[model samples]
Target chain A: MTPGRKLLGHIALLVPPFGWLGIFYLGSLSVLLLSAFWQVDAMSGEIVRDWTWENFRILFSDTTYTVIARRTTGIALLVTVTDIILAWPLAWVIARKVGPRLKLTLLVLVALPLWSSMLARIYAWRLILGHDGVLNWGLRLVGLPDQNVAFTNIALWIVFSYLWLPFMLMPMVAALERIPASLLDAAGDQGATPWQVFRTVVFPLAIPGMAAGSVFTFAVTQGDYVAPMLVGGAGSEFIGNVVYSNVGVSGNVPFAAAFSLVLLAMVAAYMLLARRFGAFDAQ
Target chain B: MGPNVLMWNTKDITTAPTSWSIIYDKAYAGVITVPDNPIQIADAALYLSHTKPELGITDPYELTQPQMDAVVTLLKEQRALVKKYWALASDEVDLFKSGDAHVGAAWPYQANTLRAAGVPVQDIIPSEGATGWADSWMISTHAQHPNCAYLWINHVMTPKVQAQQALSFGETPANTKACAEMDALQPGSCKQYHADASPAYFSSIKFWKTPVRQCGNGQNTCLDYSAWQRAWQQVKQ
Candidate 1:
């Protein structure tokens, strides 16, 4: 093909996807950003389209929004920490300890939950965590007192950790598997203790993987309104819940858009902090 | 106006709960579930309309700032009792089925689904009345077949069809004549739903709608839906 023709072909290939993103993704985001500065007419329940900072004023001035943001961030962080704790050992076992045949099986098992519907999994957790659910029933059978953890922050924490565990596990497993066995042997020859080797070599090397996984756990938990609604109890309102209610139930698009911008700012700041910690350094 | 209702586990209480106050009762703390919507403020307003008449809350959807504050305060107290605010009908069904929630605001559909699953549950339009939604089928102006759409609407509005939908959905049939059809389809179903009840029974229900500043009583001092939404977030927090 001629050079000019090749250049035209490359441009043609890029145009569709770039145009689509420009129109749909960036276009909608710009619209949302624009709407955030607009005001809603109280009497008519319509967007007035006049530029104003009233929405931001309400969001920043209100303690309710502050409390919600704090709660959402706290939950997201908790879920991420929990997933890391749960995934690290499991991922390590699959990567180093387990046989090749078992490693594939275990990896598949980690990913199995993703295949099913999220709502279905959440509902299953609801049943297992309820007052008279299997968890309590088993406790009673063991002669312990029944526990009611359903519809609380504890349940939200459990469900979020469960839902996002695979995201953390897969990345950690990949990172751990990529570490050369010779490196570990070298450490052993130098009389390095197991814990010391892990702390100095394994842990720091896995930070990038954990950070990659956290991108999923943190973002999903921060923005998830469904899990909280299905499993969360009173006082479990997340930032997503507030945005959802405003957009869906109240039809207050402007305010919802404004609230989302606050959430976007927070997530962006969190990502930057994560980057500072070398979470994405490997990439 | 909507299919939403107050549902409770019949096995938990000897007698059926007949008042909205059951949800606020301290005994049911951490076991009650209400809706997680801004429109739910109407339920609190409905309760206040009967209990606090001096507030002059003529319409639950139209509440003055003071009246709204009173409702929000009451809801804040009730928030401690709520296990969760359900956003979906099936979630409430699961709540009752698993015995997670003993009582709270629910949809008639959830109650029916639970009972069908052999869960001992009952729903009521409590003594203080309740809030609901009136659903209507609409066709877009860009419809490809308006004639077919009209035919579909007419078919659905027929007594038999209305009865089938109303019974299945656990909602009131718009067609008054559907009462007999409902009884014929499922004996006592019409009575169970108050399908042929007096106008007072219908009037007791405050239909769900967007709350604007212009109160239904011609007052302009009422809080809008956004205020309720923000207040609800605060209450839950």
Candidate 2:
């Protein structure tokens, strides 16, 4: 085969994927971003093509979006931190300590829930957290009082953490598995304790993986409205919920589009910060 | 259609509430739930229309800036009493069944469903009356089958069909004769839902309408739906 033929083969493979991304992903996004600058007829509920900054003005001046945005970002940050603490040990055990067969079993266990619909899983959490739910049933059996945490921000946090744990675990497992066994052996030969070897060597190598996992946990939670809808209480409204009501309930496409741009900017800013921590390199 | 109502767990609440004021009472704080909807602002406005006549709020759907301010103030205070703002009728059902909410602003559909599930819930139109909605059917100007549309509307309004429709949706029919059909379908349903409601009973319900800047009194003083939507956001906050 000639070098030019090889280059032609590469182009053939690249064109299809590039075309898909260009037309579907970037195309729709551009349309959404364009709608942000438009306005709607309040009475008729029709889209007015004339460009205006009124939507953005209301978004900024209203203070409601600011509060919702902060609530969403804060919750996303907490969910990320919770997943990191939860997934780190499990990922390390699967990658370093377990046999290959057990490793596969553990990985399957971590990922088993993802095969089911996300909606189903969130609804299942409701059954567990409801007033007469499994949690209270267990408490009663153990001679303890029933507790009410259902439909609260605390319930939203638990559900978000559970939903994104697999995303965090899978990436950290890959990063941990990639660490060479020779590095550990070398550190031991130098008379380093097991704890010291782990602290200095294993931890540093895993930072990129943690950053990669945090990207999924944080960004996904930031844009999620379903969990908040199913479990969140009064005053637990997310930015996504506000955007949703604008689109689905209020039929204010322009305002929904404008608010979505805020979400995009937030996620894009997060990506840049994650990139600085080497999230891209791990992936 | 039935009015928006106050549904309470008869077991938990012991005493039946006679007014919308129970929702704002600090005594029931953390045991109440309401719709997570902007339209709920109308429920507040309806409450104030009678209690604070000085605000001059005649229609829940039509409001000036100051009327909205008063309604939102009431909503903000009621927020403290709410355990959660339910997004769906099913959500309220689950809340009542699990003892998460003792009383809430709900629809008749929720009460019927909860009672069927043995939740011991009852609903009512409080002393200030309640907000409701009417469904209208319109024929398209350029429709290919306009005659078929008319036939469909006529069939839907028939006494027997209206009774069936009312039974299915837990709502009342506008046709006066449908009350007799309701009794034929189920002996006590006509009385149960007040299908044969008097003129005075009908007058109390403030049906929903599009909130426009143009007021009924030939003024542009009333705020639009967009303003209501924004005010609702602030109320929840």
Candidate with maximal TM-score:
2
Task: Please give, for residues B1-237, the per-residue lDDT of candidate 2 as tens digits.
Answer: 888899999998999999998898899988899988888898988888888999998788989998998998899989877889988888999899888899999888899999888999999999999888777778999999999999999998899998998888788888879999999999999988779888898799888887899989999999998888889889886
**Chain A TM-score, structure 1:** 0.97
lDDT of model 2 at residue B2? 83
Interface alpha-carbon RMSD, every candidate: 1.3, 1.2
What is the per-residue lDDT of model 1 for residues A1-283, given as tens digits with 9 covering 90 to 100? 9999999999999999999999999999999999999987766778898989999998899898898899999989999999999998899999999899999898888889889999999989987999889899999998999788998899999999999999999888888888889988999899999998999889988888898889889987998898887788888888898888788777789989999998898888879977876667653
lDDT of 2 by residue, A92-151 (tens): 999999899999999999889999999999999999998889999999999999888888
Q: After superposition, how far is residue A269 of candidate 2 from its true place, in Å?
A: 1.2
Model 2 scores a C-alpha lDDT of 0.90
* Best-fitting candidate, scored by DockQ: 2
How many residue pairs clash in all the candidates, one count each? Answer: 3, 0
The stretch of ten residues in a row with the least summed lDDT in candidate 1 chain B is: B1-10
